[model samples]
Target: MPKLKIAASLLAGEFINLERDVKEIEKAGIDLIHLDVMDGHYVPEITFGRQIISTVMKLTKLPIDIHLAVTNIDHTINGFMQLHPRCIFIHPETSYMPIRLLENIAQAEVLPGIAVNPTYPIDSAKNLLEYYGGVCDVLFMSVEPGYGGQPIMHKRLQIAKNLRPFVRGSMWIDGGINPNWAIEAKKNGVDGVVSGTYVFNDVQPMKLNVDSLRGESLSWRTP
Candidate 1:
């Protein structure tokens, strides 16, 4: 089994001091920075845009994964593509042709991933797996999107386990992931874990929580 990667979600980061939060996360040895972009339509909230993403891109060299929690993905994909994020994830519920969209993202030379909400059945994304030959670089399973500090729905881990054989690349578990849950996610076949609140809740300037989570994730190997 591959090593589990640690991704820090921006939703739990200090929004008031966005740039500073990202810089601190990078310094914490995070593998990737996860950005949740919600457009009021798909989810109840609208958060950030290309301007914010561009600023974030300028702040850190760490790979960025943008999760599009919106209905109007097409309206913003190009703009975000220009920023050259390491990976872009669009909801299977929002995209008209998720597989084709993933293909387009791949054609742009960026990693393409599909985001599945906790309630959405993994079988619903079967076409994506079939058409793409299960080649998505990342599979983001959201326990709860557009929010922070929710409990990790164990069923989502089952979804990740179900996709293990079909997924050719990496599988990322998002929403409410902390050091306590990282080991279970890895044991359940997750390739990466995304944490937001667990990292920013630390009062220590060095981001002890973030560093500890990353350290804990690395300690769990595939047996």
Candidate 2:
């Protein structure tokens, strides 16, 4: 099994001082930076663009993980690639040709990932995996993607559990992932988690919260 890791979601950080948040993440030694890119058509919200990604790259050396919850998959991928993300994940439902898009991402020397929605069936990923399973990472959303601060869902966790055996590469759970949720995610074969608000909440330092999420501490409580 791959070692569990945490990707701090920028969407969940302090928007006013995002640079400071990135610096704190770098200082605390979190695994990666998760960028949530949203297009209004696919997801109801709109988020970071290339400029934001560019600014973050200048702020920290941590790996950047781009989650494209957007329409026009190819265009978004091309625009974001200029920042040279470590991995780029796109929704299968949004892409006209998911397999081809995955191939293109690999060709660009970036890890290609597929993001599965909370309501999506576990079997939907099997076909995509059959074609590009070895080269791809699977990200399961524990809540709906467009918004933040939603409660974690049991059905979503079950989806991750069900897909664990078939996934060849890493499996990540996103949306409302906190320490307890992360523990369940790890048990169900999740290698990494994408956390936002819980990680950047005012109640605790980001490092400690991040550490708790990774199961480094069991006595974590909000201040």
What RMSD does each model have against the real structure? 3.9, 1.6
Model 2, which residues run further than 4 Å from truth? 1-3
Off by over 4 Å in 1: 1-3, 203-207, 215-223
Model 2 clash pairs are: none
lDDT of 2 at 34: 94
Residue 43's lDDT in candidate 2? 85
Residue 24 lDDT in candidate 2: 88
Highest lDDT, which number?
Answer: 2
The true-versus-predicted C-alpha distance at residue 56 of model 1, in Å, is 0.8
Query: For model 1, how does the per-residue alpha-carbon lDDT over 130-159 read when each residue is reduced to its tens digit?
Result: 678846865556566877888777677767
TM-score per candidate:
0.89, 0.94
Which residue pairs clash within candidate 1? none
